[model samples]
Target: MEKNNLYPVFLKTAQLEILIVGGGFVAEEKLHFLTKSSPDAQITLVAPLIREGTAEKAKAFQVHLVRASYHAGYLQGKHLVIACTDKPQVNEKIYQDCRLRNILVNVADNPPLCDFYMGGIVTKGHVKIAISTNGKSPTTAKRLRQFFEEILPEDISWMVENLNRFRKTLKGDFESKVHKMNEVTQHLITNKN
Candidate 1:
């Protein structure tokens, strides 16, 4: 059976430098979702001609914009990169450069050249969920994200905060504390009717 081998991880984008090489719709979409999830993320965008809308969005997130073509020099100090340029050759070159520098790179719409896929993310107060479709079906991941957004209660974060406070007040060994907490929260999944 086919399976997704991608390991999911949450990143602290604010602490890492990210670069996006493009100024088109794909680049805008990536920037939008990334900023929506991590408003403080430090990002730099390099494109010869940037759209007005793209420039406005970049300003909203304080993204550094360079009105020039992408080059290997832009990869300096960058931890992650997304290549979505209209020119396929340019995007491929970006991917190759990143590989040479041991940096993670994602070539938009090209799974074979990507080291990571930018999956759909849904965020509430302190709760966030990411959905991936193995880079096969992005539409499926979007649908799942919408479904989760609708089903999850708005106050889910409140419950999590309360649980955290309760956990801090517990007095017992590690195992005993875990057992007690599990018992306390068991009703969440158990049918009481």
Candidate 2:
């Protein structure tokens, strides 16, 4: 039997060391996504020949572009790694290396091999929503992102600011503060007015 089990959580990518292996269209696409979503992500790309536009994007994003083929040593010190090379054998080697080292890795387009799936993310000020179709369909996740983008309130930033202000004024220990905040924002989760 197959499993669609995945645990979702947001990572602080700004401080993480990310490594990408590949330089073709797949690599370019992954890099583009990271550059926009994780602007501060420290990414090192290991590729012999980057596809067109990749250099420009890498320069713009300040990615450490390493002009070389894939090697196991590149995985050192990396918190998250993405394998998107054009050659299946190279990608498999990288994946196997990551597995041996017990590192979190994602092998693009191969759901069975990936440790994590990059879901469609919709970010608005203080509100960020991640949409996933259990790695079954990225298209569905993307459409849901568009749907959420339209429905999300524009004053969400204001709501967050006010909530923060309220929390600051409260006098309590950590647990009490959490309880008070949960009381205020519980409706958002339960969908009750």
Candidate 3:
């Protein structure tokens, strides 16, 4: 059997228990997206002093705020960890801890310590597109995301909902259901104009 590399898995971190080691703007930005996707996600923000904006947002969203510096123990049992602190040593320590625990870790703007890069995501209902360059150029990824965000129609959610209903109503084998779904999707896209 071939060994599987986790870097290639396009995972949905929506329900994951995530630990963010920072309370600055960077950490708040990350939290903003995470909470938007999954309001119920268990997020623990660890920092010595929480910025007002970060503290207020955390309080509003009921996020767990741990007022302390980065420690190896803080990484325990966390499915995903993010190091957004300005201190290079603290970020490095978190990365090493993640490696030891086999947990996924991303150090903000530090490609060397990042196990996986967080891409710009555009989600329309059930359909989602994640744009990434494997840390080559983040600006390019943001541009692509903006383009997709503009082009993707807002009515895509209606199409997805109808397709899901069709799937539920159909009683057939896997291949037949897939064929029917493709037909529905084609019809929806064509008539959407």
Candidate 4:
């Protein structure tokens, strides 16, 4: 049986600089999801012709638009890169450039060339869930994300906040605190059936 070996992590995009090569629909899609997940992410888009919708969306976020062709120089000072240009050669070049600079790169729709996959993400206040299909089926991941969004309680964050407040008031060793916390939250997983 095949299993996914990819590790999942959450990044603080606000602290990292991101570069996207191209301004087509794929680029726009990437930009939309990135901003939706991390509103404070600093991003730069370089393309000779940017779509009007993409440009308009940039106005609402901290996104810089460089109306020019992509070059290796654009990779400078960038922590992450996304290549989604209409030209396969240009996108491949972007990927190669990113590799040389030790920057993480994702080549849109090309799983083999991508260093990372942007999975479906569901965010509810402080609670966030990321779903991945190991770069195999993104549509399946999207459906799972929608399912989770519907099943999760809207007040889940409030419960988290209250637990945190209660945790701070407890004075004990780390192990004891963990045990007590587990006991308190055990009911959350109780099987009623």
| TM-scores of all candidate predictions against the true structure | 0.97, 0.89, 0.85, 0.97
Cα lDDT, all candidates: 0.95, 0.88, 0.83, 0.94
Worst 10 residues of 4 by lDDT: 53-62
Ordered by TM-score, highest first, the candidates read 4, 1, 2, 3
Model 2, which residues run further than 4 Å from truth?
1-4, 173-176, 186-193
Off by over 4 Å in 3: 1-14, 187-193
In model 4, which runs have C-alpha deviations exceeding 4 angstroms?
none
Instruction: State candidate 1's TM-score.
Output: 0.97
Give the per-residue Cα lDDT of candidate 1 at 134.
97
State which candidate, 2 or 4, has the greater TM-score: 4
Report the candidate with higher lDDT, 2 versus 3.
2
Model 3 lDDT tens row, 38-114 = 66778899999889999988887778999987788888779999999989888998898899999989999998898
Model 1 clash pairs are none
Reference-based TM-score, model 2: 0.89
Assess candidate 4 and give its lDDT: 0.94
Tens-place lDDT digits, model 1, residues 46-141: 999998999999999999999999889999999999999999999999999999999999999999999999899988889999999999999999
**Candidate 1 or 2, higher TM-score?**
1
lDDT of 3: 0.83
Root-mean-square deviation of Cα positions for candidate 3 versus the true structure, in angstroms: 4.1
Q: Which tens-of-lDDT digit does each residue in 64-83 have in candidate 4?
A: 99999999999989999999
Candidate 1, residue 109: Cα displacement in angstroms equals: 0.2
What TM-score does candidate 4 get on C-alpha atoms? 0.97
